[model samples]
Target: MKIQHFTNQLHLLKEDESTTRKGAFIVLSAICLVGCLTFVSLAVDIGYINLVKTRMQNAVDAAALAAAQEITNAVNTAPVGTADVTQYSRDQARIAAKDVASLNDVFIDKQIDVIFGRRSFNESTQEFDVTWNASPSNVVKVIARRDNNDTSAQDGKLKLFFAGVTGDRYSTIVAQAVAYVESRDIVVVHDFSRSMNFDSYFNNESSARLSDSQIEQNLELVWNDLQMPNTGSLAFTPQYLTTTKSDYGVSATVTFKYDDLEVTSAGEIEKVQVKYTDNSYQTFNGLSGNSVNINGSKNIETAWVTARGPSENEPVTVTNNGISVTYAANRKSATMSSPQRIRELYVGFTDNSTDYRSYGSNGPYNASYSSWKEMDYMYLEVLDGRSYWYYFNAPNGGNEVTLQFDDSNWEVKQAFGLTGSYPYPRGSWDGFINHARNYSEFSSRGFRETYGGLTLMNYILRDYPGHWETPDLWKTRHFPFHAIKEGHLLLCDFLEDLGFDDHLGMVSYDTSHRQEKTMYDSDPNVPSVNISSEPITDNYQAIRDLMQYKQAAHYSYATNMGGGLEDGIQMILDNSRAGARRTILLMTDGNTNTMDSGASSSLPHGWDWDELFDYDGDGNSDYYTNSSQRRYVLRTAYDAVQNGITVHTMSVGIDADRNLMRAIAHLAGGHFIDVPGGASVADMESEVEQAFHRIASFVPPAKLMNQD
Candidate 1:
């Protein structure tokens, strides 16, 4: 009976232990399952938040960039310093930010804020700062925010899918971006002229051929010639004499020694002799001592003087010892030391400048025997049966010398005349006018065309950033390459570098004699070689070649500033080039000597030059009558401003019309770049380089100054 009772007790104890173990196992499994669920929820929520964060950040970045772009557009299209422009810029920025945000598929957002201001980086503190000034803000900042539990439509709140079971129902995300204006488009107008051939400023004779006396004056030589007191008569001893034949005629170079001794008493000059290398000689007689005239007077104590006869019947004289040596009227003579110098380099225009008259005679203030004679007078003679003007330089002494003709050392280059084709006589005012006329003729090709104008343009454009092996641009927004045609890749890259949209054209104008011949109205010969109104094109070389087509030799060399402005506007307004920032570069080196109003009677964009000038409406232009074409240019520029086109003007050499360029720039809201090519070759080249670089420089890509 006892053993059976003990077995039942053991079985009951085993049952109790089994029950405890099952309960503990169940509890542990429940805890593990809850922990796994919590972890899974956290992972899912965190991943969703990260995706939202990325989308928000991208949207904000796009919005900021858009705002910055809007600012650039405002700068390009709006009139500078106008309140309307600032306001429009702000509005555009806001609109752009919204549009970009939506396009980026950032619909579910709590709020987006776009702010415009000035942002700068502080190097000292290594931090960026923002200043609020919307009028002309350079920076655009955007912020996007989202928070959980808001549950509002498009609130950007993340709704948790699994975290809800863990009592976590919401999450928040926010993104911020800052962008600044980057890149700008600019156009440059350059002027080319004949004077540009000169190495230095106008009338710089430092580098020209000069005589010993001239060299002394320029400090290029020492004045070591023999000097004699005024106590005796002037005397000359010929040393070397030679003649050379040229296309013009025979020319002579004579070297002689001279003494400026005073003539105290009257003495007869027995004879005057001129000897040549060929054993030929000439003698003058019947000249009495009392008949001697010193300069313009026959007064006593007049040792030596150079004097010209009052008329053809008289003669120029140099007196010594009561004896006068005379050169017949129209004959020019000089006295000097050994080695005669070449005076004038090449004869140029000197009206209202020097005493050079049309008949090749010296006027007032030109001493007959001084250096002026060498500079102003050309010896006229017949040699080898041909007529020529002998280039002469005055000697450095007062001794009298007769003309000994030689033609051995004659040089056509030393003989004054045009250098190349388009021959115009030199040494006279008429020749200058003739040469100028030839330059104006369209068919005339000269150094100014091939080497001056075209060469400068080629150099500036060839080394331009566009032709670089790699496109120079910042990495941002990828430049929306899809907006450009495939054929325009290079052009787009260039325009991008220039801060332009690849909408560029050329408008060339030379004054035309025809009343109706004007820009656009007249046919631009070989239109295929001309640049047409178009969008960006990859063929930059082709455009450069087209620019070269307007060679300096082209017909119509007159500067018709109004006509150029006319065509320039038309090009900017062309239908194919619409939606681009319009700009024109009006460059010139001369006054507006030719112009035509055309039949339009109105300026571009419905403006009227007549309205600005013809206040009386008398059917004639009136305002700025002194500068009719100039007035018309300003009027056209006003129209350009109204039509949102910028016109930048460049003045080259001293002769360029600066007032006109300034007026155009002011009226069209563009900058004036005075390259001042007249300064020097180095200065002109440096200015050109700097000007192009300054115009091409653009604001860098907007930076994320501050982010959250």
Candidate 2:
């Protein structure tokens, strides 16, 4: 029994040992499997995280770049409130990111934030920033921030991979970029019109109806005056008198006259004498008559008597039926002349009617009233050592007119005339000098008051005496006063006065729009004025075709003026060559259409009076030809370009096409602006100042250093 028990125990021990070894092997296999799976998961997750991080980084970068680019384009194209460039930029970023993701076989999710800083005048020192966010699944999150700290600064950040494992994870990436706002050398062309002047009547008080202080500060009144009537007499003369004969023989007439006639005189003259003729042959010797009566007889020949006065030089002879007699001349005869002759000798006076009186000697006339009160008419004469005239009137019923004088008593008129005037001097001398000083001091000062150091340019029309008398006179005599002659000389002598000779060259003439003529119609002395390369039977039809071609040609070849295809080409070329960074501004009425046809691509319709020769039907047809307009544009452009000039063009009250203006701006790499309506003389001056400011900001100070 003992031996069997010992053997069983040994068998049990062997079985126990086998079980233990099997359990140990299973435990080791389970441990190895868990370890291997954990390693594999880590590797895959880390790789994906890195890939996501790179994609997010790229997305952020792209988004930022796109936004920046859009900003630049917006500066060139759209107005402030109307710029929708952000949306387009975001779309571009998404497209780029999507493409990249598709190539990488990874899903990407992105969010962009475009933040715009307040656009202040001092953009350089001010902070302007934009931030963009990019997030991708299992990848990184990137945040890109850009600020106008140092535009040239390169600053960016990137964060890779998520921290949490298994369930959820999060990561962050940061980046920054800095780009400078490109400084542009700009020239702004602006238009001035009646609309700019608040639709005031031309050459009327309404034209310059602003207050004195307002005028003084806001406007550089170039001129103002009365618009005189086309028909009126400056002086008057009397008609000549002659004698006549009658059937009665020697009739004598009585005459009454005064030695002196006064304007205030209301007294009447008394009759002196009368005479008659009869055939009875009766003579009355001593008849000093005060009043006279006439007598007649039947079958009687009449004879007239002659009065006698004192005869110092010669004796008077009276003839009746061939009888002659002499009498002494008297004082009454010496003083007396024929009363009818004396009455007929009166000369007509000036029409000093209440409604028609001159405003200023050279200004627009005030014809608002019908009848003249003594005070209503302006006087060329002075009274009591003062130049006085009516200053105000009641348009309603009051016949009374307020008188103004240039004496101490007339001080009130100055107050009445100069009310609500603008306040400020034109501008700093440095500022004006910086802008080439081509503008008037008054204009500069007015602009400074209204717009604070802004630059502007004014283009006034030249109308000979009318201009000199009206707006010009008003300007000189009133607000921002300047002499008309001096102003004219300043404009005419721009080259010598403003030192623009280096940049602005003489214009060249090329390309005639004239058409070929037939042998029978051709005249060497008088070339064909029509714009045609070849003659056609239908004159109108040929002209139409040529016009279309000319417009097309202008679009293709003459679209640009002073600049190249790139930006600031004109400024760069001109500034470098001329050693001065000055802008050229042109003010015109836009009435010239120099194309083959009297039409423009830029305007709604293209027929301008300045370009047409035969606008009126008066049979006279000498006027500007179609070629003149084109020639002007082309010549201006070519000269400006060749001389390295930045040309800015403005149209005032002209019917020019908008497209043409835009084209001109684009060609010159400049700005095209429309002046606002109801703009006072002050407003126009301010606008010019604004333009100058824009130009100054564009060109670097270094470029202006060499200019004297």
Candidate 3:
């Protein structure tokens, strides 16, 4: 009985131990299960976070790029203050960032943390440096936040799926991006040859000439506001010598040994300026024996002065040659007719501004001025195979007019003929009138503009942003040059708006090449090409004026495309800034039919016309013909490529040497933007603009930069 009892106790103890083991195992299993689920949740949350991070990065990058583009557009549109530009850039950048962020769940925590700034290379550190709020705002920065740190940011929280369900959620992500704008320099080579006239625009089936009345009416369509200058200014058109400009190579040789030399005598007024109380002035030259004819241009005020011949008191002279000019006499008084009210008068030489008007708001100082010789003739006469002009005084009888010279009580009044110098030329100027009638037929294509109107200054006054002349008007006008002028002017406006760093230049080609001059003639009839080799300039207004008033050359009419390209290359080499991207835009409306005499030497060794026609054993093919004239043009393009210049080609009508242009573009690493060939004026202008805009397109809007 004792043995059996002991065995029972042992069995009980073993069973109890087994039960304890089973309980411990169950607890361990539970712990292991919990750990495995926790790990799985963490893994899911991490993957989601990474995915959100990637999305955030892409959003920020896109936002930065949009903002950067906005800055460039804002700058290229209108003239605004610097503060406005900065604010606009920032605003646009922020708006863009928010827009993109909304789609990508990337939001800004603070406005200051996001924006554009100057991103430039740091020479000292050999790395790019970022300056916040710096001008030029070439760089844009964007931020994406989802850390749930800032409530104002409204950053979207990430869903961790299974992880969130298990309360092991971790939703946070932040992304940043920086992007930058590019810089460049461009030159234009325009084929101003006569053949460009034959483009489809001018190659219309009808050759009917429109009447003057029709032209005036049509000209009126291009402008909205135009007020004529005071025509009652002077008694005579001052005739003088207009110094013609020579090519750059020649101009450089004729260096000015001296100009402002110390006058051995009391120094005649070689040139005198009148600082008018108002924004106006007059000018006079060639001072000999106390006599000089003077004329003035009207500005905001209306003041007329007319002196025919020498009188007892010839208005201005070197009386004392004192520190300032003083009128020898007091004020000169004048009586006016209705609507012919006197605004201001300037005695260009007599420095003492004290000589002013009376009973006219105490004209403490009316003004002082110097005379300028303006090309004011209606017709250009070629005498002895050279352009010449003859000036004669033929004052017409009219209502007695009083010219002014007033001071204190002494009103220096002189009676001069105030005849007709408006609407129509009225007077005893029979010589000029006869010459004008001689060319009244205006058959020459060169007389297209002058066939009717006086000047183009009245037409560019329109607020035309997208409107150019219609095809119907263009076809009826039969004016191809006019079409080009209209289109080129638009390009001028486009270039004018380009950032400050860009420089502009124009080269025209006919039988020769010319770096155009700034023309201010009412008729622009004189020789208008000179000042060769002018480096590209930022003065867009000056360039526009040159294109506006400069007339077609009657001397030579061949298209010397090679000359245009050579000079255009020179302009770039002489002026472009260091480290700036270089480009050449060649615009031609016809095939190249002419080249320079040195065409063979100008080309590369293997690229010369060819040895195919070498009668002599010499390497070069003897003579080049008109057929291969385009090859030389193509060769010049190759030269441009060797110099690292990007060459773009443009053509308007079917006559454009498209194949040659295409070849040139291919060889020189550029695009051949074919402006459709035809009478579509609006399309032509639009094409010209697009061509230039395309050149501008090379500048990337914004690109992502590595972040730290």
Please tell me which predicted candidate would have the highest lDDT against the true structure.
Answer: 3
Residue-level lDDT of model 2, residues 522-606, one tens digit each, is: 2243223342232221133322222211111111112222112112233234333212344544433233323333432232134
lDDT of 1 by residue, 312-418 (tens): 32333333211122333333433321112223222211132233323222212222232223232234221213333344322222223332222121211122221
Among all windows of ten consecutive residues in candidate 2, which has the lowest summed lDDT? 257-266
lDDT of 3 by residue, 1-708 (tens): 999999999999999999999999999999998888888877877777887788888888888877777666765542655656556656666776677767775667438547657765444764456787776577878777766644344675565677755674546667888876654457777766544433211123212333344333334433212222232222221111111111100100011101111111121223323323255555444443212333333211212222222222332121110112222222132112112222333222223232222224233222332233211111112112222321111112111221222110011011111133333222222222222223333223332212112212111111111012111121222234555666566666654443424556777887878665443333334324343444466566666665654333312467877778888787777766665567888877767777787665345667544443344567765545455577677667777888888888877665676766776776677887887633344455566666656655455436677776
Comparison by lDDT, 1 against 3, better one: 3
Q: Which parts of model 1 have CA positions greater than 4 angstroms off?
A: 1-63, 66-501, 512-538, 548-554, 597-626, 676-678, 698-708
lDDT of 2 at 223: 21
Report the Cα lDDT for residue 266, model 1. Answer: 21
lDDT of 2 at 227: 25
- What TM-score do all the candidates reach, one by one? 0.38, 0.28, 0.45
Please give me the total number of clashing residue pairs in predicted model 3: 18
Regions more than 4 Å wrong, model 2: 1-172, 189-571, 576-587, 591-628, 631-650, 655-659, 662-708
Best by TM-score: 3
Q: After superposition, how far is residue 616 of candidate 1 from its true place, in Å?
A: 29
Off by over 4 Å in 3: 1-51, 70-96, 102-105, 108-114, 118-138, 150-173, 192-500, 514-550, 554-556, 569-579, 601-626, 639-644, 652-659, 662-701, 705-708
Instruction: For candidate 2, give the lDDT of residue 15.
Output: 100
